[model samples]
Every structure is written in C-alpha cells, then in structure tokens.
Target: MQRLLVALLAAFDAAIAAAVGLVVLLAPLTLLWTLAFGITADWGALWPLTGTLWEFGHGVPLAVTIPDELLVALAIPAQAASFAVSITPLAFLLFTLLFAARSGARAAAAGTWLLGVLSGTVVFTAISTAVALTARLDAAQTPLLLAIVLPAAVYFVGALCGAVRVAWEEGDGGILDRLHDRLDVHEDWAPVPAAVVRGAAFALVGVVGTAALALAVMTLFRGGEVVALFQASRVDALGATVMTLAQLVYLPTLIVWAASWLAGPGFAVGVGTAVSPAGTQLGVVPGVPVFGLLPENSSMWMLIVVLVPIAAGAFAGWAVRSRLVWEGTPLGTAQRAVIAVGIAVVTAGVGGIAAVLANGSMGPGRLSEVGPAALPFMLALGLEVLVGAAILLLSPRHRDELAEERTDRWIAEMSELEPSQAPVVPVPGIPLPRAHDQAFDDTAPLDDVRGFRPPTGNRD
Candidate 1:
C-alpha cells in the first residue's frame, strides 16, 4: 500500500512537471500570438510551435527550413536558408530535472525511492511520447525517437541521482543498505565512494560559482557593448522582450562556455573563431547581445584563469578530508588517492556532459560549430583537478588533524556512556568522587557551609 501510494504521488509530480513546462511556453506564446496576429491568426500552429520549442529546449536538435516564399522575398542565400539549431535553451530541461529530483527526494523520504523513480519516469516518457506524436512543425522538425527519449532520460537520471543521494545517507532498508554493509566490510574503502561523490559535487559547485562570478564581471565591464548591440538590432518592445527572455534562458549555456575558458580550451563562436583567456582569434561573428561579452583581445597572462578549476579541486579535497576526520573514518593514503582520482573523474564526466549539451550548431555556415569541444574541456579540467586534489589528498596527515580526530572519537565514546557507567578522572592531590556515592539534587536547597562535612571515603 505504501509503495503504491509513493508511486502514484511520483506520477502525479511528473505530470505536474510536464504540465508546468508546457504552460510556461504556452502562456507567453499565447500573448505574443494574439498581439502579433490577433484572433484571426492560425491558432492551430500555436500548440505545435510550443511543443516543438519544448522539445528543442530538452536538447533535441531542430532541422529548420525557411519557406521558399520567405527566402525569395528576403533574398536569403540558398546555403543559409536552412540550418540546424542544436544549441538548447536548457532552462526547460533544468526545470524538469529539478522538479523530478524533488519528487524523487520525497519518494526516498517515503522509503520507496526505486519504485517512485521508475513510476515517475514512466509517466514522463508517456507525456513525451504524446508531445512528440502531436507536435509537428513544417518549419522546425525534430527526430521523433530523440523527442520521446531525451526528456524522459533527463527526468530518470535526475530522479535516480536525487533518490540515491538521500537513500545513501538515510538507509533505504533495501538494496542501498545491503550495498552499504558490503562496503563497510572493507573499512579503508568504506568512506571512499561517499567522499568522492561529495568532493565531486563540491568541485562542480565551485567551478559553477567561479564561472558565474566571471560572467557577472564581464556584464559589468561590457554592459555598454551589450546595450549597443541591442540598440543596433532596432527591435520593437515585443521583439526586445522575446530577445531578453531568450538570452536569459541561454545563461546556463554561457556559463558552461565560461567554465571551458577557465579550463583553458575556451569555446568557438563560429567555425574558425576561438574565444579563450589565452587569446581571442576571430573573423566575422554573430551580433547577438550576449556575444558582446566576448573579449575582443586577450593577453598571455590571462591564461592564469586556469588556476580556478585547480583551486576548486583543492577545496573539494579539503572538504572531503575534513568530513572524513569528523566522522572518525580516516582513510589510508591509497584510499585517499582513489578518492582524489574519483573526484577528478566525476568532475570531468559532468564537464563533458555540459560541453556536449552546450556545444552544438547555432545556425548555418560558420555558426555550425559553437561552444567548447567536449574532449579537450574534459581532459583539461580532469587533469587540473587531479593535480589540485592530489596535492591535498596525497599529502601526509597533519598532527593537528590526527589530534582532532582522536579528540572527537573520545568525545563520541564518552557521550554514549550512561552516567553510572562513566569513568572518573582524578587530578593530582584532588580525589574524585565515587560513582556509588549519593548524588546531589540540583533542585534541593543548599545547606549552610558551616555544618557541611566530607563523606567518609578514600582520601588518596
């Protein structure tokens, strides 16, 4: 009964997530459609447009084709008339992942994480299937199979991660518990997996934070350039609003590019352009307002930005080490080494995935290659992080750290003892009271000191 309830609730959560994403797309689109073409406009195209965009936002690439009449009227080059828009907005996908994660956490709390994740994924996939089947656009077409699978995959992965994270800390009384027990048998390696995961999470957070800070600094310094581009576009209020919203949605994509820059590989704005801290090499580039953030020139000294990821890795290692000490589960040098490597590997994997999502065609011609190359970014970040983590994790244990661990262990042991079972400590020339002696009640009134007498007991 409990499992069934959890599954049902999870399915409900999945439906809400999908519905909310659709509504978000539909609402603004509805207003825009009405304002642009009035009630006489083809309302049938709205749902298809919304659905196609939703699919695109989930990382599905669209094969965009300009209508023959529009192309001829606009005098667009034949080569530029059709192109693939693979760079996803990522906002919708992010929303779904976060909602699914929340639902999975709830399910883990309910003690049915696996069932909840499976049920939620099944429902999400069904919704995706319906959307794929119904949403057909003559201008923008997405792969049917990809449209059905990608969103569901995103939800599934997010839910599994969230559920496992919670269950790992608070036993799920099933598979996780058994796995934990098995890991426990090997004391040295017991904390390795959890520590690695924790450290990797910390590293990713640090990288993202640094990337965001860099983006903010760029915005502050380059605000005028962005504004200039926006003004040069000469867009009306609605177009401007739409442009702003689009930029906002692509913020995460920009952050990923910034991270790649910090990692030293940088990213490409077009086929032959390179925007890196080391140097900025380019020819003609798109005039998107966000592109204004790109540095026109770079100095060799700017390569020092690569240190950012290293610092993040070092911070992760310190955090993991502190946690291990706090928990009285100090690992051996080999175990720490494995943890450091694991942190690097995990960080690299995440970086690679982000690069894959962020690096895709933005338009026809030179715009075909945009964002960072996944392999370079991953290898660079992994190596840099490994160096930093190794510096912390592979180093000899400090005396202070060992002393703190011992102190914590002692305190925990003492805390577990009953009052009567607590051992007494004696000071030189000061006898300790015996445990069997009558205990004084703090609530009772104190008697006069003049009439007070010592109990008859050992004085030594």
Candidate 2:
C-alpha cells in the first residue's frame, strides 16, 4: 500500500511538472506574436520581461505589457505574494483529491478531479483573457498563451488529484471510515440530513469567503493611480490584474466547494450557488419578469432563479433524509444532475442579464469587448455545483458501507478472543497443574479436598 501510494504521488508530481513545462514552452510563441503585431507599440521591450516572468512563474506572473508603446509596472512582489496565497488552495485540493482517491473515496475523488480540472481551465482562461485584453499585447499572443497554459494547468492539476487519490485509498484508516465516525448518529441511524446541512454550510462559507477575498484583492490592487499608470503607459495592467484576481479567487472556491460536497450535499449546493452568483446572473439572461408585470433588474432575476434551485435542492435533501440509509445514497444521480443543471442555468441567466443591464446602465460601449472567457468559468462553476450536490447526496451510502466495514472488523477482532487465553495466576515457587491432570487425580477423594492445603504447609 505504501509503495502504491508513493507511485501515485510520483505520477501526480510528474504530471504537474509536465504541465508547468508545457506552459513555459508556450511563452516564447506568445512573445513572438506580441513582437510581430505591435499591440503595445511603445511597450514592446516589456514583453521580454513579461515572457521571462511567465516562464519562471509557470505562466503565473503579474506584469502588463502594451502592444509596442509603453509599460507600467505594478508591485510585482505583492502580486506574486497574492498569487502564491491563492495557489495554496489548488495545492490543498490536489493533495486532498489524491488522498481521497487512494483512500477509496470514489465520490469524493470524482468530485475533486472535476474541480481540479475546472480550476485549471479557469486559470488558463484568466491568463489568456489578460493577454487578449492588453491593447499593446499581440493578438497572436492570446492563442499562444492559451495553448500553453491550459494544458499545463490541466495536467498539473490532474496529476496532483490522481496522486492524492491513490495515497488516500491505500493509506491506513480510509477517509470513509473517518467520515463514518463523524457522521454516525446511532448504531442503526444514518446522519444524512446532518451531513448535508454541514456540507452545505461549509460550501456556503467557503464561497462567500472566496468572493469577499476577490473583492478585497481587487480593492487593494486596483487603484485609480495604478490604472492610470498602466493607461498612461499604454499597458493593460488593470485588465490583467482583474483577470488574475478573478482566477485567484475562483480557484480556491472550487476546491472548498468540492471538499464540502464530499462531506454533505446541502453544503455543496449552498457553496455552489453562493460562489456562482455571477454565473447564475448570466444564465437569467434577458431577465425574468417579476409579477408578470414589472421588469426587475437582471441581477435581481438571476438572484431569484439561483435561490429557487438551492431551496429546491435543500428541500429535496431534507425530504429524503429519513429514506437514506447509506452515505452516497440520499439522492439519485438523475436528481442531483437536475439540480446541478438547474442551478447553472439560473446562475448563468442571471449573471448575463446583470452584466448586460450593468453595461447598459453605465452607458453604451462603456465596457470594452472581451473574449467569452467568463462563460467557461461560469459553466465550470455550474458543473461543480451539480457534481458537488451529487456527491453529497450519495455520501450516506458510502458512510453506511464504511460503518458496516468497521463493525465487521470489530467483530472479527473480538472473535479472536478465547476464554482459554485468559491470563494465568502464578503461584510463587510452585508449578501449575494441568486441569486434566487435576481431574484425573480425583482418586485422592473429594472428601479429603474439603480441607484446603496451605501454601507453606502451615495450619491457619
């Protein structure tokens, strides 16, 4: 088991290394495109620096370069610090996934893998989006960045997830056993409702925390002075910052939500809905007519739609609590899938409508045209919600299986005990007689045995 775990971990590490390598290799191509296109006519010299940083950081750098004009530098150290902080969640996720998988947590393993992939995609999109937004950055650079970053991120994330999974499954005391103890209500009772509630709460907290963190980061880093500096220098610092910050915030939320889902269904939905409000808003596109009369803000409509699904999922979970007998058996696959899709649709519609409304309200053409990068992020979020919900709902069955296994183990251990194996009482300086030998010596007479023999042959 230890060997298997080591092998799995090694594999995961290799995959992550390959991903990093791939991203590094693709940096030069993007640099070439930037040089050719004259995107930032004045900031061309900075591309080399940006490329160097990108290569060094595994495509996780914080520098903005215009097409061919000028460059404005931000606190690179600060950005890098934040980036490192943000990546910690990804590392945690990778570790958790490999552990869960190796420990035989099928549902959790699946959920983690999905989340890791989604995170990678989000990161890749953020990088590409940053490049695309840079007016001075070559258009060709966008594709090149995507080509390199996406695969690298995915491979690394996948490898980490796979390794953790192997370790978890093969390691002593599986996660399932631990989860069973945590969720166990009684010998015969299943703690489905409790698990769901806990899971949902964790997810919600994680999502809200992530969003707040993103906002805080943006507020701290996206100052008017910084924006102006980049703008004056004809560098796309603000846009790059926005993209990077979004990725940083979103990645952690994915891991948190995934972990929570494994712990409970309600939590997964709550987190999924909370973290994915932006996507939900987008899904409510056009807008939902409130009261069939007044047209509400798309954001408002999106909120309503997203809330409805969450509420429905919660209610469903509650209803089936008593019926669920095992961990991972509370909600069926179809039901979970429905809820996930519903949540995604609601989130996307609302987010889209809200974005459109906000843009329209701000004035026409206020927000510049950007690629559909946010769309994939939203879609990934929605999918996460669904997957998480399913995992939570199904957890009861897994829990029950673990409980039974534990019980069986306990019984097996007890069965090994024998009365004959009881500790013997030693008589000092005297040899113990065998029970059979004593029985055969009955010829000494039962009456004579009425008087007890003193150990020292002294009458007392």
lDDT for each candidate structure: 0.92, 0.38
Native-to-model Cα distance after best TM-score fit, residue 43 in candidate 2, in Å: 16
lDDT score of residue 358 within candidate 1: 94
lDDT for 121 in candidate 2 is: 41
Score every model by TM-score.
0.91, 0.29
lDDT of 1 by residue, 13-113 (tens): 99999999999999999999998899999999999999999999898999999998999999999889889999988788889889999999999999999
Q: How accurate is candidate 2 locally (lDDT)?
A: 0.38
lDDT digits (tens) for residues 1-460 of candidate 2: 6444444544443345434433443564455546655575545545544433333223232223233222225433332221111112233233323433332232234434333433434444454345434423332232355435643454445444453444344432455456556555543333433343334443344444444454445446545544444454443545454434434433543333322222222111111122232232111121111101111222433333333334433433333443343343434555444444454454444333222211111001211221122344345444444454554454455666558667766766767865444335654444454775643432343334545554696677
- Listed per candidate, the RMSD to the true structure in angstroms reads 4.7, 19.9
